[model samples]
Target chain A: MANDKVTLAHGAGGKVSQELMEQVILPAYGNPVLNTLHDGALVEMKGEVAFTTDSYVVQPLFFAGGNIGKLAVCGTVNDLSMTGAIPRYLSVGMIIEEGFPIKDLQTIVSTMKKMADEAGVVIATGDTKVVEKGKADGIFINTAGIGDKIPGTHISPENVKPGMKVILSGYIGDHAAAIMAGRHNINLPASVQTDCAPLNKMTKAMLEAVPDIAVMRDPTRGGVAAVLNEIAEASKCGILIDEDEIPIHAEVQGVCDMLGFDPLYLANEGKCVAFVPAESADKVLKAMRTSPYGQEARVIGEVTAEAPGTVGLRTGIGGIRVVDMPLGNIVPRIC
Target chain B: MANDKVTLAHGAGGKVSQELMEQVILPAYGNPVLNTLHDGALVEMKGEVAFTTDSYVVQPLFFAGGNIGKLAVCGTVNDLSMTGAIPRYLSVGMIIEEGFPIKDLQTIVSTMKKMADEAGVVIATGDTKVVEKGKADGIFINTAGIGDKIPGTHISPENVKPGMKVILSGYIGDHAAAIMAGRHNINLPASVQTDCAPLNKMTKAMLEAVPDIAVMRDPTRGGVAAVLNEIAEASKCGILIDEDEIPIHAEVQGVCDMLGFDPLYLANEGKCVAFVPAESADKVLKAMRTSPYGQEARVIGEVTAEAPGTVGLRTGIGGIRVVDMPLGNIVPRIC
Candidate 1:
């Protein structure tokens, strides 16, 4: 269990990490699904399955509003939900450095169990390994999942059309700014909290409301700008996003300005960008705003035919700016 | 995507690592199985499936006999083989450090695909992440897999009873000595190449010859000593082994003596410790000795109900010594 500190034997995959599992991780969430001791979990369920896996190697494992455990659960669950799958089962594999603190591990794992139960995804199977101190940071998590992929509901980037409107799910860049402040201990006028929560419910609601939604993407690592260019390229179309209509929280905007960062490039975990038909844009926004996660949703962009394979931004200076692909990493390990 | 020298952007899980996948890892072995992005690779057959996952994080990712890629494939396939599952599909998730060299990345990935083909397991899905330079040694791989669990075959530790003979499939400690020498530049009088190779064929042959093999374990980490003790505790039986009967290469023994290390505690990448009923021990040994991985198989010990939960070693001096469980780590990260 890589809690706070790390030792070398943890990565050895020997008795040290095995004991940590028997004593720490296993006992806290003991159930029949976990005791089978199989490699990847074997789950018997009653619906079409959607499986996804994500690896989390976040720096400063314990962050401001959430840790890697919470991120692991939410990240994979959201992937399932984006496809309108009812998130069902999850398998967690943790690699920790030896000599980590026991208390810190407890806090992170307890948080994970709570968050998973809230998301209606059961923790079915798990694996624990400890690496030598220098071999790892603090702790890293990789979660693979099995969910019921919705029947006959397929939404791909190729589905985007010329007059589709893009919806910004919530305030942008809050997760990125929160992490930066926590790591550097930066003082700010207002508290900055990470927008790290399970987005499955919000995603399912959106899918139910608008079954024809096209190109659903979580603006995570490279943020909205990176994904916008990717969606445009994939659909062979153009995206024209409004500058002022895009929503940003005050604290996040202040941090971006102070740090020479752009809200467009900063990461956001709990939010998503969805492209839908122009006629239903208002109705979709109304449905999104009713959900807890999409309270700040807005129609911020539209698909265009004039400039295919590119994304253009309407700037505050009354000029158009091409929102090209992110040149390099904007924020490291923000997820 | 563990390039020779890692860069910080790899850990970002964005563009840099994505390029690493497209250029280095994926192109080296692009196939239809890999194009399907699944969590654990799905192996379709006429019946049930077997699931497996293993993480590889070896220091100095490239080595003399083989690199971490070979180890990852061979190790996980061997695990599936031990469970009597015809090893089939594998998923590799690589966590690479920033500043790693591209040349080394190409070498490791090419070897990985080649070895996967030879072992008869397809690389179905893969993921790549880059960490900052200090976060990891070079690269760490997490592999998850699924295989078709064969019907009408039951193998477990509970089958071990009094009078079962222990069969060691090959020499001990060669891999351990080779790694220590190569990593630390120990100029001992030994060209001790590691005994690392795929063992699925050999295991398959042996299982066919002796269908009721009691227990089978790959003595990779913590070597023969750990497996011996684990079987003793699990089956509630004692193991009486003649130390002289155990096979060890001359070079490995020489290195073990100079370093004040017990050969029993050292790791071995290509070896197996099996328990079979006395009636089938000879048949199993003959079956194993016919294969590349188990050509030097030998009978080393016998199970006894007296002095349960303990392993007793018969010394060359005609004295008996009790072997205790290891307290400190011996050769951490030997995987």
Candidate 2:
């Protein structure tokens, strides 16, 4: 098993690499779409479509709760979900450093396959290249997904209304904390893991519960603040988020406090903020709560017309502060 | 126009980028596949298929002979052709750095669109992302391709026979020489450019003229020596290349001579090698000579029963030398 750890042969596309994919990665996440095992997946859906692409250069390929592989798939699927489409296919391209262990590659690929299968998406096509050892940090993955647009669903930031309520799908900062914890080898694990998961199913349930959701965004890179700021800028409306209303897991919050980090600025993968008419915000959140990924759904903010392009947060202490877009990298390269 | 020299904005998928693609790329080489402008092209054909993917990370996005965009398309298409397939569709992904000028991106994308069109392949799908200044050097392109296997064209190294002759599609090292020439800024009123172009049309012609061609390959990355050595190893047969019969343009030969780079290991974009029955080799060469990309086609080698897995070269001095597979990177990071 010691020999099963990272090996240069894994990047060689030879037997060692094959074992890693077939044994570790695929078994955990294999499905019909992911099983095709083709270069790029082929998807057959009948409808006008929306397409989205993303690249994951997350450092520390294997993080706390999950690895870069799962992040790549979740990020891409979430992008399509935001557009009200059912993502069906994906293209994966990996740039690996030559000396990278075959075992690590196998793990990453198997994870990708498994995640794609779970999300009902396929890894239709893939390309792999080995760069000289020093050219790349380890392995970087780039993926593009295509989804069939829902027949009549349209959700855009421009649709946010003054009376709309902002819905947080689940706990925040779990993924970021988990990754940081793993990277730094933080001791004493007490069930603190990354919340990396596919949001497509959650989006589907929310839309089915109430199809009139105004805006849906996964707070990944810049977290809740970046997404909220963008929605405000686009809708020309102000946002008021209650600090206590946002859901943060106890472990994640504890880690954030210990590290002097703001949980609001940390990344969340299996989470999203949905703006809905005040009348049906409860209905949407109720439906989200029933989904596995959104059990912690809560109302974090409300849309307002008082101050345009600004997101104001009511402090837990009855004070207020502005939530701004992230300036520099946080948890640098945390997918 | 001086303004048209090069700018990073040209590849942004925005207005100026569109302009560059429309003007330089489309105008130079426009066709049905290139016009669709999808992220990954939709290709339909009836037959078993072979697909391949490649990424171009050539430094100095624009080199002496061609740019990253051209290399991306050519590399994928060439792989498709080598497998005896009709390359019909291609997907492109570009990772461009922020602050790159609008003009440069345009030049690159336009070149890509045009070259794909000329290759008779469509640019089906594309994705673009901007990395911060230091993340990426300038621009990196990734291309994936699909093609229908040509009927009756079962070419493979496994089919090479004792009496088969090898044909060179054109002169060697022109492309590498062109890049070197451009990089050094050598003053030559009559400077030679890279032989960068689509080889599909020429490949199609060869298949039509002689469907029984045993093997076909493009000496692009590791060059002709690499390809030949691979075929020899795969087929478990010896190969004898006639140095005098190999084609080399005067300018290309001059550059290679000065640089001490052998033509056999030099990269070629618009060229290929075909191993066929001695009887069909001449006819195949004639067919190759008719296509724009194959005007310099000629027979340069033959399969032999002696010394399996070894490739020998007959020198101009009447001596024989074993041609081993390239040990190190040849044309490092070309495509």
Candidate 3:
């Protein structure tokens, strides 16, 4: 327990592991359900619920604006929120490499606790594993979340139809650019920071106001381009967007251009693209703008019957170009 | 799509990841909930439920009796079952090293699917990430399970009382011995196999007959000694175990003897120790012995009021020895 670095014995599920939980982890995430110290946590749930999982392997555990722990919590919470569910419980699984600093682990876990508290969710259960130093990266976290589905709400791509509006919440490429900057030691502008914040409150309010939204997705790894393409394919419709309507911070745009990257295909941790019926677009946008995380909400596109399952961009120069799903790893480990 | 081995692109949330899911994972785990391909799965539930998670970093991905995939599924399932819950939905999060064989991945997924089907649970949702080669071990699986708790069942250490009988489902040390055999290349008799099996059905049946079972704990990492010590500490009572009654496979005993390891402190993947009122012990034993996994069920000890917060073993030679929670990693990444 006195060791400053993690040791394999700390994950052997023995006295050392128990001590670590009691001394470090439990203090950060202790609750009635977790305090039982049973193999599993017993909880109560009613009606329908949402379940989701994500593994955060973002390199540079400490990144601009947030760390892997923060992303792990927000990513899964956002996934549940995208389904019109009230985020409730989450289980964390950590695989730490031997010799990793215990202090760093504490910092990461504290970040997760803070993020979970802000999202109105509890760390209900967890597991920890330690591998030899070289067998794993510094640390990887896998979080699975359960949320209560809102009544009278059904969010699915099947509901998308022609004349639906596509709204992008806030700027794009910030998360990707920020991670890239840290990983490659790029001197990015100070404003280029990870937009890694939980969007449950914002999305919950939007869904409450407009329960008929067709689809909701966080633009994470493959970013906005991939989400739109997926929505188009799932809804069996075409999407046409105006390039000028897309919001990209100048710093992020500069970084993307420097790396020959398209901001549309860069990841954003705290943003969502929602497909809403044309009639409800204005109301949903207004609701989104009221939230700090969605202040830059913009109606960037609309669904179309022509060219079903494809996405087209109307360039500011009056030219049309097809936007395809991201193909390869333009930016790896971007969360 | 033509790639024979996994690459970083497969974890990039781009075209490759989608192809891998569609061509490899989806077909195996495609259920109504997962087929939706939304960020999270929507499931219906009412009343109390059990939630648990475990990360499997077992070395020697494939062992004599099972592989990491089997352990991953059964470990979480058994954790939920220990709470007297009927295992239902599971979420799998896999982190794979780049260049890992696609065929191996398929084999693992297939094993998971088969185990899930046998447990009568659905692979509800999952996430996949591929780290750069060497950044991770071959692969590590994190599974979080949700189960519906049985009504009228109150299983906890606090319920343990004097005169309560302690029953163990089967032999100990098989899982740890099997992993150690593979890791150290120790030749072992063919009878030495990992006792990796799901105990949900058997447990559900047993609980039906004995609704007031005091505690149920799977003797996994740190083994029976650790579990008993924890229960004693939690309930603020003393536990006395008849060392002679503890079951150990002959081959496993040989391996442990040679390695100077105690079977009582070695892990068992599919075995559990239950505390039940003396009146229900016989009925529970009969119920457990009826199941395939619990054929070796035996009454190994009883709860006592003396020496609170400690565990004592009555040796066969008429001496008593204190058994403590494991201190260090006798075996690392065993399960």
Candidate 4:
């Protein structure tokens, strides 16, 4: 507390470490379960549960709409949500570099608390470690989460059928565009902020409306193109998407065009691609559109038995082009 | 597979990333739960669960007895064990720097699987992120675990009372001394390696023998001294330990003496400090001794009603001294 910058002692598991937990961390995310200060937290869990983990290493720390802290929480939360689980608890493990500003650390921790609260999950248990300066970046956070599975839903690629409809939750490329703008000092319109929000509520509503929805995935690092390719390969089905139906913000489109980037391959933090049965597509779309994060939800594609294990895009020019799985380093550290 | 060292593409969540998973990670830790390759793993869970998280940033990556990977798994398992739980599932999150050797990564992942198997836990889910060369050290691992609570046992500081016996599992300070020797290029005896082993089996046996064990703690990072101080403060009781009764490997003691470090304050990745009722002390000690990791288990102290919130050490020469909670950076990145 005496130093503005974190020192190695703060993670030595001694007096200083205890002080950091009591003064800095506990005040922000403290709850009955975490306040026990035991080796771990004991919580009640019943039935089947979804488990997931993600490490956030985005550069610049802060972005247009959210910081790395927000991503840390939402990423795992969305992963569980994609499994048709109601996310419940999260464990935060932070690796901080010595000499890092404590103020920034506070901001990050507070943001994590805010996002966890918004997602209706508890910050149940955590650990902190500090590496010597330069040995690590400012800070890297890993969040692992658990959620209860929705009873009647089975979310898996094997459930994908030839007549299934593929839906996009909202616009794409906003998150990656925002990160690129910050890195390159490019000015962008206000509407082009990162679309990094907790999609649990939206996905839960959709599942409640149509429990038989086959598969759901958040197109994150490799974007929609990569997600579709994986699903196609795993389910041994073909996917054909209409380029015109895909939504992209105008400023994001302009930036992607100028930078020679593909909107379909750019990362998105808060969007989901769901494969639903043809008969329930309209109902699921209506459910998604009711949430603020998924207001632009639309049917963008369909699954087919032809050319199984491949994805094709029907461009506006009336020619079909294969959308291969993204390869090489299109954009590093987008998450 | 063509690259000998990791590149940014290996973490871009695309073709290369999938290749890394299929070729490297899956071969080491693959199981039905993890093979689903969904956003998260859906696993069965029932009753109460213990959840914990830890990030391992140990330097040198490889030490005498274990590497960071082994520690990553063992550390979380031990935390769950200390909470009186049967660790069942673990999630691994890795942050690797570009240019790190693929061979080294394979070694680490394999080691994690080995440890997880030994501890009777599954690597249920995981995530990987890569940073630029200078932005991170070789690699850091964060492991979060969930374990089912052992029936009929309540391990908490609140269970501590006057006249309770404190049982310690095995010799202390080997882990820290081995790390120090590696860092300073000191030649340690072959017998003095890092004592970083999973303690779940030993703890499970002890709980089965004596379910009323008051408190359980692994003396890591801040060592036995820090654990005792915390227990004393939390339970509002005083602890008194005899210096001569504490077990310390001769070579580890020599290393500590030469380096001006106190064995009691040095870390032990495998050892545990347990507070037990006087009547159950012998049964718990016998249970610990049956396990190879806890063969040198012994009673080192007793809880007292006098001088609450303090720990005292009785010297061999007939004097007592207050053992203050460790302050400042005693040893950094020892894990």
Name the best candidate (by DockQ).
Answer: 4
Residue-by-residue lDDT tens digits, candidate 2, A246-300: 8877878888888887888787888888999999988998888788988888888
Best by lDDT: 4
Give the poorly placed runs of model 2, Cα more than 4 Å off: A1-47, A182-190, A208-212, A254-260, A277-283, A317-320, B1-53, B73-172, B177-192, B198-219, B223-247, B251-266, B270-329
lDDT for each residue of candidate 3 in A225-318, tens digit (9 for 90 to 100): 9999898998899999999999988888888888899999998899999999999999999899889998999999999999999999999999
Displacement of the residue A220 alpha carbon in candidate 1, Å: 1.7
TM-score of every candidate relative to the true structure: 0.86, 0.69, 0.99, 0.99
Q: Ten residues in a row with the worst lDDT in model 3 chain B?
A: B324-333
State the iRMSD of every prediction, in order shown. Answer: 3.9, 7.0, 0.8, 0.7
Q: CA lDDT of A108 in candidate 3?
A: 93
Q: Please write out the lDDT profile of model 3 over residues B181-273, one tens digit for every residue.
A: 999999988788899999998898899889999999999989999999999999999999998999888999988888899998898999989
Q: Per-residue error at B42 for model 3, in Å?
A: 0.5
Root-mean-square deviation (CA) per prediction: 3.9, 7.2, 0.9, 0.8
Task: Give the CAPRI class of candidate 2.
Answer: incorrect
What DockQ does each listed candidate score? 0.28, 0.12, 0.88, 0.90
Worst 10 residues of 2 chain A by lDDT: A36-45
Please state the error at residue A232 of candidate 1 in Å: 2.0
